[model samples]
Target: MKITGYTDRLSVQPGENIKFMVNSHYKTYKAEIVRLIHGDSNPEGPGVKMEKVNADVNKEYNGRRQEIHMGSYIKFDAHPLFATVDSFSLQAMIYPTTPELGTQGILTKWSPAANTGYGLFIDDKGCLALWIGDEKGNVEKISTNQPLIAGCWYFVGGSFDKKSGKIAIFQEAVISKTNGKFSLPYEAEKQNVSNERKVNIQPFADNNAPFLIASVIEKQPDGKHKVINRYNGKIDRPRVACAALSKEEMSAWIDQPSGKDLIAAWDFSAGITKKGFKEIEKIHDISPNKIHGVAVNHPTRAVTGYNWTSEEQNFVHAPEQYGAIHFHDDDMTDAKWDVDFEWKVPDDLKSGVYAAHVHCGDDADHITFFVRPKKGQPTAKTALIIPTASYLAYANNRFQDIPLAQLMFGRAPVVQQEDMYLGEHAEYGLSTYDHHNDGTGVCFSSSLRPILNMRPKYRHNLSPSLWQFNADLHLVDWLTEKGFEFDVITDQDLHFEGAELLNQYKVAITGSHPEYYSGPMLDAVEDFQAQGGRFMYMGSNGFYWVVTFDPENPSLMEVRKNYGNQGWKSKPGEIHLSLTGEQGSIWKHRGRAPQKICGVGYMAEGFEVSSYYRRTEESGAPELAWIFEGIAKDEKLGDFGLVGGGAAGLELDIYDEELGTPSHAVILASSEGHTSVYMPVAEELYFNIPGLSGEENPRVRADMVFYHTPNGGAVFSTASIAYCGSLSHNNYDNNISRLTENVLKNFLLDQPLPGAEKQQVLTKN
Candidate 1:
């Protein structure tokens, strides 16, 4: 809890440099590099096995506490036009989600330290207000009598006339059946407000201060400007004019945002192609001055704007209706912390999962990162693809807070120290599962900040078991115990380099719970299989959700969840991702179910306890008998494990021929006896009815499947996230371990499989 850090990247090839940014409460901390073989701290398991590595960065160093500045806004350099302006008007289409929270600045060019300049804001009373300050610290403020309603679009404008010492502020609701929370039958009294007043003081214009939208700037003690009073909601088509425009002129400008009096007219829909936003961060200014701005942090874009009519749901087809940018006060893309140490991996270093271990006194933390083989220089015949994308999606997730945590887990949640810290310190950022302060779903997640849950020995509060990162280490430990030399790569590498990266190895294994997959990542794996590469899907709930990374920053991932077994749903008409302009949600909705690639798709999930797999008739077939060679046909497999006491718990998948499971695929084993807490996924149900729990539903179970692919390749899928957790049972001598080893060993051989000749004969007939 005292010393924590994160790497700039999730994976780096040998000979490439990677940096670590650390924050410490103590004066100094010791740093060492260790290869993580096993991370589960359960007494019944190996107990956190890590091998120390002699790296150049292993030394003690002075530590400094780093702070995270969290918020999203748009900023542009102070132009000469802003410095000379004596009388001006500012207007924008605003949708205030938390107008009553406090005073929120909509548009400003003011310096809080000097208290000088002009600004428009939502006052603490939730009313439209205009503010102007003089050089002597004197200020004039005017507020409307009526408070604005939340979740409704309003044309908000403020203006000042220096010559007459007059100020005016107005708000008008622009609501339709599909545009806002209320429709025509709703009362209009709280939707409109207007006010005008005369003041004696003239406004002071600061030339050095940057113009900002959705937030104000305050000078910190370090003489740097920091974002403050951030507005939470959406802002569309903000414009500035040199003259004191009236309510009518401001309304006209919303339709035609260009004129001689215009100083700056930011068109939020500019640079949008039929695909998606071309320059996502760049805000285009249409006026002659070209005072453009850039978005700070990653705000939700390509969202429904004030004028969206529900006629066109896709932003790519109607960008004009999707010009708004949703800004959240808690939005954070990067920590931007100073680097504490850097390490250039040696060319001969092994490819595996490694972490920078930092400790001061009894407090300690580990910053994990993956090391891949050098470019065009693979050192092993097998590779393990770390599910980095899934880790980011669930990073810093507050699962303990879920209302159904107890009901779903069938017990009270087990809160850890890391979980408590995340509840208190929210500056690090929210995960995709969390909603923002304004109650909108968070669609984007970044890895550039500290992720406490991604560390070794961390357990999820819901299941109180090893989840993504540490759960994957179970396979790493088993592979090492079996003396199998395998290289390590990540989802990031697979996404960028595609099939070429997987082609370097004969067999590829996936991490436990590769639930999120980008289109390119799926393509690469499929392409590898088509090219005679064997695959071992060692986990469950994989290749379910569709995700895409920011082209500019691969560490940032985006997902728009709508229909699925998810925590939150995207707003209406905003189900498509802005990064790739592709539909977001479960891959099955896009016609690429996981069953098509791995012969298994997510079916149900439970957290209370794990069951075991039962051998099916297919397992006794001569063509598939080798998979269960060492185990009796009647013996239960994976009956015990560190995860929920068995391997077939957690999330389970099934082989469904109706959902694209290959005709030749064989269901070697199927699990049974799940508790009633295990329920079918929402996507599988057409109606909300009873008898959907595991006790009644026939589909809530995991299936172990094997199928041959093109050329000499094949796929072996164990459809449960807890499968790997059972590998260390009985000191890695259990039936689950034997079954996995048999497939992996045969998968590594260059010769044809045991049943290849029989399969060929059947195909010829």
Candidate 2:
């Protein structure tokens, strides 16, 4: 049996207790502490490594039972009269997205055990297709003339006649068009696809089992039945007829799915909540036949429907639009199970990355979390605030499921076992890159459950190297090797405690992709820097996207990527977040560009190749020479190492005075030799031009920057996500490591720099 778990809290301090919640089908399980050494299982880099914590947590959770809540789904047991339908018709109102790719099941009565049944679904080419199989294993299939467009509602249906040996399908735009042409872009090609279509087909089949909506039951090679090819859009008012209906009759049924001669009809609007005529998770079939089914994957309810007029934003006001059910292939609200064991951190436990190591027979996995120092007790001069918010945004992302990513990466994807598990068990929920049931992009993400991609060795679809959480761990290993004692904190802590949380430490460090931030967290960091706390922003794209977390439920966070900057623009009136009611977008839109606090902000991103930084004349100026004390004047910093084999790669940031980069900020070394694939971030360019790549656009490269603030404060930015990955080169004795050591060793002394003292004298005058 499979097992999984989560904690009520993401991080805990010594002397404080945290609860562990588990969902498993096993009788017993054990938990123990395992200090995380390295998460990347890259054989060329660091292999997966963990060490047992000599604590007393190695105990079994006995007598635990699993609670069943397998998500919302429709189910109907077999009935003799319903099984004799070899010839039939199917109809549904659909609003689809990503219809051009991936198999999407709409209506089906297929049995994998016998491989004998019938189904009507969207094929890989986005065209509606009808397929039927007989006892002899012969199969018949045909599709519509043209593909359906995404983001538009359509009346779709098909029929089969065993007697005539012929079948046909009818597809039309829900909103009758004057020209009969729709214009929604295909995701990858950005080419417009239409919906007006007609097709013909015929099939003989055996309906010995129940019919499924939005999903199909398929037999796996392992001899187990599994649900696959879940629909990723709205499905409303579905019905089946025992006899073929004329094209005109089928078109009229769009508004009347419960017409006469029907085998079954479903009113999706019925039984929405647990108190509504039925208990939790049960959906009633408001039809004469009472073909009831349960909602599965917790497909979103109360959404804008196939016939929505865009006149109402709150679905409660428009009951018709609310009738729709949104089914995402990667949707999961929870995986209800029992706790394996709990940990009440001891009073003396050190703050660091720790894991709850679990094992059942030969199967094993680790549940990782952070331990921070007790409130008001600062244990180290340096504090590394984990970018946990960013982690949550990109958690177990579905980028691999998109064809656009494939083209950009220049190769077909290699989905690890972890990726396959995420697709099969959608109970874990969706990432920011995925769309919701209503064809709207997902804006909220939570970490209350296991985020498969946040572990060690996890690689992102955007980059071959480690990213977000895993990439940040590179710095952790570096600090250990260098014998630097550091305290651990998180973006959550910074948001909740304000600047006070960082006042205890002399310096604070950010991770490799601290992309999401709340107003309070950004303010706290700025205040800390202004009050003489040294800030080491070791990553590109830090403090970029704005986000807000649920105070009542700290595990969940929200973000809305409206049309301005990048990736999946939000629809009108939906940009205001439900959690905080804040207008969501990039930080730059709110006048808080990364340059404002760290003297550098997001500039560009590239994956295929990485380059190194070449020192500028300013780096050797008498006042800044101390930063390059041990390096030769001609030495190329971060020229060779892990992560693209150089420091400046992946997402990069650059200094921009107009965007609030300190007027006095000094650019020491600017990364050179980025390939043409590296281009300026979209927002920076008013319009696309020939010279936007790294080879031409001056702003496309990372510029290592340093600037001084009031009260002896300073900000040092590495300006590249790949910077830390090179810190361990030559066994931690490389120039990049040396330069970073100089910055931190000087900052940790808790004294002002030469320029800072001069500024202080001028202020006193």
Candidate 3:
């Protein structure tokens, strides 16, 4: 995999130092900072471009190798009982994901500070391996007979005896069904492999606090301990006994009740709540000594365990079945690279997108960051708040398996370099749309890692076309082309500063898919609107699913997808987001659908073809003629352009009074001639019935809505993701362009729109 990097802060001001981190396979590399000019792939449109900003930002660093331990494992605080142990027995259930990587740490008490400890891990040869290194670095290592296959559950463990001076380790396959339905693949049956090694009867590593699992601590020469050799795979209940157990005793412990020999046993599936899961920061112990451990990177919790029967999906109800932690070798939250260089934005720099462009031989990459005008400064009347949370949710996503993906695209997507990189590097991490090794869907995502798909020219794996960040760039390109001055504030900015961050701008624009929102973010938008701040929900599916972020842990974002308008459902009791204690799923389920603000909420979606919007009778009314000024009454708005070659297609929304569409809201236009594949949203249906398809359902279309809030605040929604992509077509002279220009002209004016004053009267009526 090629090296990539990201900044800690999305948008930075001059005098603020932003950390720059890189993940590289090579040691020698160069870096520099550049301003991003444009991020589009359309050969006909503005091509890939950038501008250099600083010479001091350019430098070189010999990037150190940092191993990302992917598998989730637990560690207990050291007690006199655990620390004094000389010989002990350890056992765990392992489902190897990458047995070929070799030397996967299953459990260990090894820390490099003391350079001593014992551990049970899978060897590089994919064999059950046991290693015991003493204080002097003297070691005894041994492995099992045959190779262990990947994705199969096995019972691998060992026992060390001080009196006998022998270390015994064995690897035996668990032939039974794993998730109650998944059985191990047929492998050649051979005698169980148990190896014994005679070692010096020295006390185990005396380091009192070096105990860990999945990784070993290597004390750097600089006196800092670095965690290394992280194992990649799933690790189940790992138990440690104070002393060695006989083979027969071990056999009994495997299928029978593990007796008092267990000094400490960790059940990785103990705590997650429906009321809120944020309280589950520590895993509760089941052993007599309750030395619970905290989960790092929150490794894929609520996953299926070896005991899962496939009968219960909720981990809360069947905790035993959800005891596994799946890990990967490439799960990076931050590259943590030594900063080759850092810069505070100069005060005079414009509020736009910028990046640190790094060149390493033939390979080149960019570490992007956004710049906002000085705090409290309004350089422009309008601000475009990027849906960065939604970007995080779909970051580095793999949607090729979704049945709708290919069917919606019509043809196979043209794979980009980022797509191929993602496919080859599954260790980079999974999107919220994906599932863990145990089959439970993934919900939490973090931006501390390299998200290749978030870059310019990045294309969707299934759609080939630009999506989220890249697709949003189409609108960015439009605003720049039209010479409209606007400050760029990200969803992160809205989350931190809340309403105050948006109050300065007369109006705020949203990129296409604002699918993820936190309570504060939603409140900020609503409060800004309630106070007369105009909102331009420029795309469909705005304010959709709920998400959570902790300022304490800014790099991590969490979501619990359950109960609405999505592909995968969260486990029942786990529907509440653990990060913010808020209920997940769609915002509509929370009684705050997008329609309440913009008069349009998600309705349906089809990717094959984008159709045009027909002007409603409401649009032609003399008072409302301004929105359609200079356009023929019979003209089909946005009939030909970029995305799907029209304005509405990929995903559409509708105006519905029952769903809280404002009573005085004017639906100026509605898209028509949609294909059958565009089906209504899941929440819109009470039952699976026929004719819920695009052509049959009246609501399967986008609504062009304009509504005035109190204090001159207004909301105009295009209600389609494909809307902005059409703006640059025909050299920006098309009907879509004209209509948008007209709206912007009216929206940018200093007073309430003349027609909207009448709507206010109608609202009071």
Candidate 4:
């Protein structure tokens, strides 16, 4: 816990350079390259097994503590127009989500150190306030009598007249049936304050200071500008004018900006398409000077603006109605740390999972990364696709803290040391499963920060067992023990390179939980299968959510949770992703069910204990007998495992013909004997009722399936998230290991599978 870090890249090829950024309390730390084979620390399983690799980066180095600054705002570079403004007016449409969280800046060019310039802000009392400071260190402020309400939109403006020494402030609520928390008759009682005051001091304009929206620049003791007074809410159509406009003119400017004195009018809906905003960082300014701005730290865009009506739900259909940009005080996309060291992968280095093992005194950390086969070159016939996207989705997730977590798991939550650190250090950022400070669901996750939960030997608090990254390592250790030559690839690589990356290998294997997937990643897998590349879906609940990477920054992933079983739901009219304009939610809602490609779909889940698979009657068919060559007819497959004491515990899937499972697909085995704790997934139920647990529901089970595709290709699925956790059982001597080995070995062969001909005939029929 004392030392932690992350890599610039999740997966690299031979001859590629990867950088590591560390934050350590100690003066120095030891570093070494270790190939991770197994990461589960459970004594019952193969304990954390990592092989030391002789690499050039293995050495002790001095360490420095790095700090992460968290906040989302729009920034414009210092321009000449900002410095020449003596009598000016500022107008913006504001929707404050957390107005009572102390003073927050809406628009400012003020310097906290010198106390100079003019600005508009939400005062400590949550009222609309105008502030002016002079070169003599004198400050004057005027605020509205009534406080602004949260979850409501307001048109706020302020103007300072140098000739008359008069300052006027306006705040009026804009309410619609679905635009705000309250509407109709309630708007009459809402706070609508307009005040005018006389000030003797002239405003000091600091042209050197950069203009910022939703935040103010505070000069630190070191003379560095640090963003402070971050506002948590939405700001739409902010306009600035060099002339001091009257209260009525200010209102007109807020509605439509058109005047000779207009300095800048920012249009939040610019560049937005029906497909979504690809270049999300650029904020276009519709002004003669073209003083544009850029959003720092990704803010939620394509949100409902003040003029939004309930008629249109998607922003692409009505961009003018969706001009709001939601800024959160806690939003963070990157740690922006200085690289401590960089290591260029040697050409001869083998493809696998590797990490920089760093330790100082008793505190240690492992910055993990995947080394894939050399670009466009394959050294192995098999490939292991690590679920990096899923890892990011749950990065630093506070699962145990979620309501009813203990009840869902059917036991007390087990909190680990890493989880304790994550709870206290929120600057590390929130996951897709977490909610922001203002209660909105987090839609974006980035890998630039240290992910405590993605480390080696880390266990999920909810499962109280190895999950995701660590759980996938169980298969890695098994492949090593069995002496199979295979390469490793990550979700990022798959998403970027597409199906061409998988074509280099004969067999492709998924990790223990590939739940989060982008459209291209799924297409690549399907294309690979169609091109005669065999696929092994070793995990359950895969290809579930629809996720997309920021085209500008691949490390950042975006997902809007709606429908299906979710931690939090996206707000109405905001379900479409801002990065791709694609509707965000489960892929099944888009008609691409997991069964359509992987031959299985999520059915039920439980964490108390795992059940065992029972061989089906179809396993005895002569064409499929080879799949069970090492097992007996009465034997229980994966009856014992490190996860939930068996392989079918965490989450289960089934071969549902109704959901696009191939008609030729055969259910070779099905699990049974699950506890009442396991319940059917929400997507399967049309109505909420009782008798939905595994004890009474027929759909609560894992089904091992096999089927063939076009061009001599094939697909195999072990529909359980805990399947890989059982691979290390009995020192890899168990039936589960034997079954997986038989399938994988056969899958790796150059020729077609045993039942390919029969499957082809079935498909033709």
Which is the winner by lDDT between candidate 2 and candidate 3? 3
lDDT of 3 by residue, 67-88 (tens): 3434344455666766778779
Which residue pairs show collisions in model 4? Answer: 275-581
Report lDDT per candidate: 0.89, 0.73, 0.74, 0.89
lDDT of 2 by residue, 56-133 (tens): 777776535343232234556775435677678888888777686667788887765665677778887888777677
Which residue ranges in model 3 land beyond 4 Å of their true spot? 1-3, 23-32, 58-69, 74-83, 87-106, 110-117, 120-203, 206-210, 214-294, 301-332, 360-362, 400-405, 564-567, 686-692, 695-697
For candidate 4, report its TM-score: 0.98
Clashes of 4: 1
Q: lDDT score, residue 255, model 2?
A: 58
Please provide, for model 4 over 316-335, each residue's C-alpha lDDT reduced to its tens digit, 9 standing for 90 to 100.
Answer: 99999988999999899888
Higher-scoring candidate on lDDT, 3 or 4: 4
Task: Write model 1 residue lDDT over 631-749, tens digit each, in one string.
Answer: 99999999999889898988999999999897778899999999899999889889979888999988999999998887788999999999999999998999999999999999999
Model 1, global lDDT: 0.89
RMSD of each: 1.3, 9.0, 5.6, 1.4
Error of 1 at 593 (Å): 0.6
What is residue 569's positional error in candidate 2, in angstroms? 1.9
Candidate 1 has its poorest 10 consecutive residues by lDDT at 756-765
**Candidate 1: pairs in clash:** none
**What's the TM-score of each model vs. the native?**
0.98, 0.70, 0.80, 0.98
